[model samples]
Target: MSEWFYQESQTESFLEREFVFANFLEAFAFMTKVAILSEKNDHHPDWRNVWNKVYIKLSTHEANNTVTDKDRNLAEEIDRIL
Candidate 1:
């Protein structure tokens, strides 16, 4: 998953990525879109925002914090939003 940076710890494995935007407003707007999408899919990302960048990580908490089809699907949809 070159498009995503994969990470693992004793408790979890996740897919992480940074989405950059032209400005802070753009990044926040994108996050709003993602919030809608996440609500629809019932899969929310672990994310942080700093100015023009959004750092996202996906892991299935119910699946013991591992990446699953839901994570991949959400990641793809987020990419499409870009």
Candidate 2:
């Protein structure tokens, strides 16, 4: 997968990804992992969950709407967990 970090805005660009899990348990497990990483890095993702699906949109709040290395790094971590 490409490690491309795009700028964040009040749009849905960051929501266009393919993340699938077999069941709710698997999805919740991934979310738990992500939550820990987010706390460690102090960078949270705007996300929602419905059953087995997770929607993630990341942005650097202190950096306005621009995407930074931190976002990419967190995304890598998330990909690893998933």
Candidate number achieving the greatest TM-score relative to the actual structure: 1
In terms of lDDT, model 1 sits at 0.94
51: Cα error in model 1, Å: 0.6
TM-score for all models, in order of appearance: 0.94, 0.79
TM-score quality measure for candidate 2: 0.79
Give a tens-digit lDDT track for model 2, residues 1-82: 2643454457433422445689899888988998999999998888888888877877666766456677778888887875
Best by lDDT: 1
| Tens digit per residue, CA lDDT, model 1, 1-82 | 4689889999999999998899999999999999999999999999999999999999999999999999999998988887
lDDT of model 2 at position 82: 54
CA lDDT, every prediction? 0.94, 0.72
Tell me the spans in candidate 1 whose CA falls farther than 4 Å from its real position. none
